[model samples]
Target: MIDPDLPLDEQNARLRAILGALMDRAERGQLPSRPMGQLSDVVALEQQVRARTRDLAEALDKLRVTNARLSQAERDAVGARNTLADALEAMGEGFAMFDARDRLTLWNSQFCAALPDIRDQLGTGLPFQDYVRMVSESAAIDLSGPAERDAWAAQRLQSHRRRNVNFVVPLVQDNWLQVSEQRMNSGGTAVIQTDVTAMVRTERLEREKLLDEQAQMVRATLDHIDQAVLIFDAKARLAGWNRRLREIFAPPSALLASGTPFTQLLNDLMRRRLLGRGNIRQVLTDWVNGPASRPPLGLDLVQEDGTELHLSAQAMPDRGFVISFTDLTRERRAIAEMHRMNETLEARVQARTVELEAARDAAERANASKSRFVASASHDLLQPLNAAKLFLASLAAMDNAPAQSRLIGRVQSAFASVEDILAALLDLSKFDIGAARARVDTVPLGPLFARLRDEFQPMADRRGLQLRVMPCAASVRSDPVYLKRILQNLVSNALRYTERGRVLLGARRHGSALRLEVWDTGPGIPPDKQTEIFREFTRLNPSGEAGMGLGLAIVEQACALLGHGLDLRSEPGRGTVFSVTLPQASAGPHAAPPLPDSDQTAGLLSDMLVLVIENDATSRRAIMGMLEDWGASPIEAASLTEAEVQIADLGLAPDVILADHQLDDGATGLQAIAALRAAHGDIPALLVTADHGPALAEQAERAGVLVMTKPLALRRLRRVLQQVPQLRAGQGNSAPGARRGDHSYWLRAGD
Candidate 1:
């Protein structure tokens, strides 16, 4: 069992030492080795030595195998523990373990990471509650309650069994961490912390965003709407309102104040209530709920400041009611205007209806008057003609006697007056029936004045008054005969009215107009009676006048016919001047030149020819005689056809033609003149009518023809004839001779 290859010195030393010890013992051992008995003792000792060596070797081998098995078991246990620690450190949750004394026994890396501030205390095994108290106190987290401490301890103790805990702890970043606990057999507590910061932050942000959007939506919707909107709390306190409500109820000062009481605001509103009819409370309630269950309430509100508003209200249960007010002042004004317009229309309609009825009544009266006039005229004609016949027969019976001649002259004169009246009446009828026409021609004023001078000179001499014709170079487009008639009537009236005064007939140009003036230094017309003088049948001086009051009326009518206006200026004792305005002719040398004698007979006619057309035998004869006396040849025709024939057959080409408007064949002289002028050239023509109608005169003037009423004075006839150059001067190489005649010689037959 022992190695036998030992060194000899070592073996020898060992034997010697043993022997020496044996001898020392056998002083006690030497005597026994030399005998048979000495052999037995040596073998026994050797065997004991071998046995001891073998037992020592066997003990060493067993001790070496036991030590190897114990080392292998310790290494396997260390590897398993390292794997468990790596698993705990990989978790997101903070993990820690504490002992039954609440001291930290074991803690993973995550626990130290989660609470870095307490990492130095981990190995010290501090109580879990103390660690929580330290975190609460130092980090500003609250963890003071017993329940919280117990809960934390329990969470640590049961950390492995639970996924999360009921209570969470918040960190400085506003992040939340869920905690769980478990208890270990080692009387330690385990804690797990899980981060839930993102979930909690998202939830909170969502709530805030929703509130902000809601507030913005409410503000935008209320502010832009036309109606007023109010929001109130459950206590009926005002919380918010739109701009419309603020404008209606709150002044700028009050709205800007910090905090105004709802009750006080309501009281102020009631004091300034726009509706006066209802109590404030009742009105507010009605506005909130409407009049009927579903019907709206409409009211016209008049504020204390006199502002009118139309209001409509709608209610919301929790949000209060919205009231809309619209100013209606302009609408009320429009309504008033409409009312006035309606009243005006009604008044106009009533006035028009009344005027129509009045016009109808006037027409009926006029018809009655016409019938009466016809009957009276028929009766009057019978008496005058019968008396004339009787006188004529008696004169015939007394022929050859000198007394018979005088009787015949008186009879003739009486019959002539009657005939003139009848003729005037007939002419008036023709004018009324619109049968009158005009023959228009150019009329010179120079010659017209000359003839007037010759005729009125004698009359003026007899009356011891000066009669003058002022110089003028003016011609007009008008009816020459009618213009002469108008002048004759005016001059005659002047002579009749004045006892002794000079009468001057002159014309002056006013701009493009000519004013024919007849001025007399005699008794003037009363201002109040001047207008009446131009009316038919109106007279200012009636005594010693033996004709109807129609002279001035005819003059006025003639002025109107010629498109001329008449103006009168007078004073009671001074004199009267009557002016007739006519359009002036274009200025030229050939247009009615002024006469050579500027002072004496300045407006006299030097050379002119005239043709006289008359229907009545006596009138034609008288006109021809007057024209001849004025040194003017006069061609006569009884009818328009006869005049036309005479004008054509004579080939005389007279400067002026005078014709009776009412011819024998019911043909107007205007038709005859038109026919003659068409065949020849435009010649001056005059129409003689007994018509006194204003409309007839106007028609004659409109046709450029002159109209003269019946019973014409010879002087006026001569003046009109002299106004025509071609008529006064015969159609010859030389001018005709001028003849001087007494004004009385040219006097009308009746005069």
Candidate 2:
């Protein structure tokens, strides 16, 4: 140890040997307090301290490695927990969990959100019973009274106790929810509530559709039956009928309905001279009520015109009588023809049959070709016009230079003129093809006039003309949609022709009819010209006029279809008056009530939720954009199924539905709206269609939907939207819809 020059390895070995020997001596109590012994002891202690420090350091190094591994495991565990929470939050269905103690332990935001009214009372540590009580007291929808709330809750609680059970609950809002409860491994329950309203509505609609198909099948069977079938109730009221009966009797529509008294029907038949030779009163009464008074009866009667009819009656279980009428006129004629045929040649019969078949085939082919050509041409002509209108509307909505804005206005006017011409051509084609038909209903003149006023006001303002619609108290039996169109064309023609004088629209009673008149103080038409004015494309002054003169033609055709009398009076250099005489109808449930006078300028379309089911992307976008400009929330869907998904996903009900008649997938907008209303409450619906005939309007009316024809008039659209009860002022787009380009509709009901 004293020799510094010794080899390093040899020195370290000597030091280790000395330390070991010293430690052994120390262990044997050999180390003394002497300086030399103390120095050796200190040295030995140092060696021992160094060796122990190394061991401690090795242990510390292992502990550090273990700590790092533990930290990573903790991070992974935290990440997993956060991931689970995010997944729960992202679920569309409401999710919640409760521990064995029946206390809420976890829940996604929708868990409480779905409850609506009692969400404030739900949270962790909330007892299941307390939550149930809160729900019973504050639920937005319930079918049971408060008295039964406790009982219902008790039953519900009992159901919850069952492990892994699932059930369904219905909300009074017409919403159905599926509640699934899963037993968690930790003695807890996981609940998932999914909205099944759409599913339930689809099922119900399917069933209703099936029933409708079955009814149609029955109607078709009855229509095809050879014998004319009629049924009268025990009270002798007319009930059942078929096409053959209608053809055989040619009874007036009112006389052949479900509730006409048998006596009245018989009287009408007698008045028409259709009854056969019999004791006038007693015999006919016996024929109608004999099935009830007696077992059954059969009668053969010969009409004054030499037609024979066979009637057989049988009593139904419901005390009604089923009567069958077989026309024996054919049989008698067949007998006569048989006698005559014996003297005829077979060659003549064959020649006549071939000639008739050839004529019929030629006529059918010509009609079919004409119809196809007209339909295709109309669609092609209107498609570009519709697209142009949409783009112009969009451009008009943007902030533009004044001259540019004026240019857009002119373009819009041009588009309107083009559309009108196309529409007129289409209408003419429909009328010629017999594709246009009338559906008679009770139409209130007051409301119809008010709508007319709203529509014509803007046009009148543009021309500095006063268009006034006089008060009306009458309701008429007519097709309101077509009638409105007819009047629109009439009033529009009057406005266009009359330069300065006010256009007056009013109705007057004439016997049992209402004579709706449109008076104009413009240059009077000559008697010679007035007669030809109704002809298509005939105009008195064609110079600087954009009108194609098809308005009067449409009016003439519509009047003919509706059986309305058209009267025109004109004085040279004075004025002209045109009137349509319509049969006045009694005020009934079918009458469309007058619209309330609301400020059209006030936030009419503000804050309204409009679900538009339009297949045309451009039209849909245009409508959405326009509604957005008006501050209405518009939710667009291409089909009913898609609309349903959007409605469900948005989790909000629509106030009104605006749809196009022809949707994709062969589904009508009416069907989509029907499905939505079946799931939700009755929502006001307006159907827009390019189909201009009365057939489309009638179909819409039959489905209880209002028609808004396309190329939609902005003023008319505004007026119709004003009438929708769903629109309310000061509402905002606060749902998921706002981001999806849904705007709001504001309502100004008063002032």
Q: Write the residue-wise lDDT of candidate 1 on 273-296 in tens digits.
A: 644445655666544434222233
lDDT values of the candidates?
0.59, 0.72
Kindly list the per-residue Cα lDDT of model 2 for residues 1-751, writing each as its tens digit.
Answer: 5354764445555666766776677677665566586666668667755665565568779989999999999999999999989999999888988998889988888885656888777778989888777866756645467776777678778887788767666676777777898888888888898988899788557535643543454466578557898878778788778899888788988887878887888788788877675675576576655434344556887888888988766665456677788888977886686567556887778765676579679878876676556665666555445545665676687645467699778767756766777677777777877788676766768767887898789988877788989988677889765798899998988887777869999999899888999998778898889879999867774312326679999999999999999989988666789999989987554333443543445376788788988887866777887778776889999998888899899998887898887877688887887888899866767887766666666566556567766667675566667656432232222211111100111212110
In candidate 2, how many Å is residue 505 off? Answer: 3.3
Q: All candidates' TM-scores?
A: 0.33, 0.45
lDDT of 2 at 518: 97
Tell me, what's the RMSD of every candidate? 57.2, 26.4
The ten-residue window of minimal lDDT in model 2 covers 735-744
TM-score of 2: 0.45
**Candidate 1: stretches off by over 4 Å:** 1-440, 586-751
Name the top lDDT candidate: 2
lDDT of 2: 0.72
Q: Which ten residues in a row have the lowest lDDT in candidate 1?
A: 740-749
